[model samples]
Target chain A: MTVLEARDVSYQYSVGTPFQITALEHISFSVEKGELLAIIGHTGSGKSTLIQHFNALLKPTSGQILLYGKDINETKETARDARFKVGLCFQYPEYQLFESTVYKDIAFGPGNMGLSKEEIDARVRRAAAFVGLTEPMLEKSPFDLSGGEKRRVAIAGVMAMEPEVLIMDEPAAGLDPRGRRKILEMIENYRRQTGSTVIIVSHSMEDVASLAERILVLNHGKIARMGTVDEVFSHAEELQNMGLNIPQLTGIFTRLNQLGYGVNPLTYTVEQAKTEILRYLHKGGAADG
Target chain B: MENDSLIKFNDVSYRYESDTDTPLPLAIKNIDLDIRKGEFVAVLGHNGSGKSTLAKLANAILAPESGKIFVNGMDTSDESLEYEIRQTVGVVFQNPDNQIVATIVEEDVAFGPENLGIEPKEIRRRVDDALKSVGMYEYRFHEPHKLSGGQKQRVAIAGIMAMQTECIILDEPTAMLDPKGREEVMKAMQRLNKELGVTIVLITHYMDEAVKADRVIVMDSGRIVLDGTPRQVFAEEETIEKAGLELPDCAKLAHALKRSGVNMPSDILTPDEFVEAFQRCVSGGGVL
Candidate 1:
């Protein structure tokens, strides 16, 4: 089922002024239920603007945003309704953590939804567990935790609402390897537990390659390509030309193929690359014979 | 070498006064560090590892609770030398949006020199040269807000360059940028380090960026756990991981190959190195 869709979406900033600029033009795509999609593009390439339209945060200057095959912006109540069903966690979410305690922070979203105290408490505990926050830490002020822990509080705040579709923008940016791993692990766990559709807006190709089921390449306000990981990543030269990056492990394979090594450039994960390179080495580098 | 060192820390220790007063107050423990002139150094650590604290100490943004930091033999703790110390060491923080002051790129770049009360002609020459050096001359008249993340960052670097600061410390400058923007900032830093012989102290989480630096410093729990050349530092895979960091994917693959009884070097940091190793293995006289 198509949970979220953009039909002929277009947006312009400062329209009809001397500084007028087209931010998005005729952008169209559909995201399925339970599918993990990563939207990638260079800075100011309309990624942030495109995500905003999904929840009717920014109505397309032209074009319709469809939720469950119905226009989300059809009415004021529907536009407000779409916000809860599609939780959008903006970049650097930790800075938005102004709650007194981690538990209260996580409960804020559900509280806004008018859930019962018992239900809100249950959801808060569950969300905290999803991000690996301890019982004692929940009582502490969200401001007192480490950078990684604080990030978890903000993510948990969004997850607590239990949105049908979860979208996070650069959740792991500026984190250490362990912190990043924790966030990635929590996302995988969240999907496995809830089977929710996940859309991540990120600039790190490596992170996208490791988790996303499909990838969307955005250019200067348009969809350059949208496909499964193999389809998008295999066209390494094309993505690079658009000022994007492939996974580091994939880049190695890409370079080897460019060097006449005949290695498979579709290798994205480290484990996959290890197996392919091992096979090639044991086979005397003969890729096909 | 000691005499030529631009910044030296003698048994430095810094403690952040947390509001909650949680344990682990020491942001950086007792340590000694020497940053020499014209050296390009990369600092690697996860968040809360005190790398930023070390950067702040270099220019006297924060005085050490204990120990002493000296910039150009002038103590950072000495209030009289504070201006000269900051003039000697320039720091660029993570967000370009926060660092930028003036509306226009050229004006922002010229802000430092103008603040230093340089002659109008000298400021004009320095601003143009600085902007040109960072490849942002074309965007000089453009609004700083209109430029891309990378362009804004380069403009920040140009602002520092206009001050003629001998050393530049960048704290996670590319963390918020896209891959292309990250690449652009790295190229500018490299150019500034090479062409002008400006010392660079880069604090980053990306292992790939660290590969370009002359030296790599890894911190864990507010202490330097590993410090050496990129090759030497990355060779300690276990140590890097223990510090809450990971090796670059290429280097990790090389290590995996080494563990599986292949003859690949454990320190391969880039795709080019990995390809060369694979080629060697495929050409025989190796595991096959």
Candidate 2:
């Protein structure tokens, strides 16, 4: 079932005077429930602008976004409803954490939903646990926490609302390797538990290859390509033309193929490449069939 | 000049000002390092691992509470040499949107030279040269905000380049950019280091970027936990895991293969290296 769909969505930014910059044009795609989609593109490719339209953060200039087969802009109430259903976590979400304590920050979302005080508290605790935040850390000031911790708290704040469609923009930006891995693990765990539609905007091919079941390649505000991870990565030349890359492992496999090694041409992850290489080695190191 | 190191940290120890306990929270502890002229060094650490603090010390943004830091043979503790040290080592921070100041690209590039009180003609020459070096000369007249993130970062690097500094320290310059922007910025940094012979101290979280540097330094909990060429540093799986860091995916795969009794080298930093090493192992009479 299509949980969210955009029909010919287009957006324009007015710089000044009468002139306007078209950020996105003729964008169309549908995301199903429990699908983990990654949007990859170069800067100014309109990936962020398009994702903002998913939750009605920006009204389309020429088209419509349908959440559950209903146009979001049909009514203010509907748009507001869409906002809760689609929890949009902006880049550097830690900057949006304004509450004094982490608990208050996480509770802020559920509290705004007009839930019972007890229910809000329960939801906040559950959200914190989902993101791996400990009990002692909840009462402490958010500003006092480290960068990665603060990011998790902000993400929990959104998770407290229990949105159906979770959208994250570069959630691992500026994080170290361990922090990046921890956040990725938490996100996967949350997705498995909640089965929400997950759309992540990122630049790292490795991250996208690992987490995204479907890859959406956005170029100049248009739906350049959308397919499975293997299918998208197979168009390495096209992606490179759009100023993007296949995963580094893919590049290495391509190089090995060029050097007369009969390796599988469609490897996206290190494990796949390892398996293919080992298979070739086990076949008496044959160069070709 | 051959005997003199460009930058040296002698048992340097730093603690944040907020901590009051006897054993303060050390940002960097007992760091002893020597950086020669025109060396390209990449610093890797997870967040809060003291890599940024170490970069700041090179330009005197932060002083070591214990030990000494010498920049171009001048002690950073000497207040008199602060200006000289800062001018000798320029810093480019993470966010290009935040670091940029001027409306136009060329003017922003010229800001540093102007601050150094260079002559107007010299400033213009430096700015033009710097912009050209980073492949931003064509965008000199364009509004900086109108440019792409990668272009803006290149402009930021050009600003530092115009200062005519011997060393440039970039603290996660590509963290805020997309993969293409990252590629552009890394290429520009490599070009600056290769062509101009500028020493580069790049602090980054991306293992792929670190693989290209001549040397890699890993910091953890305010300590220089690992330092060597990328191959050497990435070879120590236990050290990397203990530091709360992940090896490059290729390195991880190599480690796994080694555990499975494959005779592959454990220090593979890139997919290309892994592919080459595996191919060689198969062809060089290795047991399957």
Best-performing candidate as measured by TM-score: 1
Worst 10 residues of 2 chain B by lDDT: B16-25
Query: What's the TM-score of every candidate structure?
Result: 0.95, 0.94
Off by over 4 Å in 2: A15-19, A258-262, A285-289, B1-3, B19-23, B128-151, B285-288
Q: Candidate 1: deviation at residue B107, Å?
A: 2.9
What would the per-residue lDDT of candidate 1 be over residues B1-288, giving only the tens digit for each residue?
Answer: 678899999999998776655655789899789989998999999899999999999989999989999898999998989999999999998777789999889999989999899999999999998888666898788889977665787889789989989899999988878887788778878988898899999999999999999999999988899999999999999999888899998988888877888778787988888878777776654463
The docking category that best describes candidate 2 is medium
lDDT score of model 2? Answer: 0.87
Which lDDT value does model 1 have at B197? 94
Per-candidate TM-score, chain A? 0.96, 0.96
Give the worst 10-residue stretch by lDDT in candidate 1 chain B: B279-288
C-alpha displacement of A245 in model 1, angstroms?
1.8
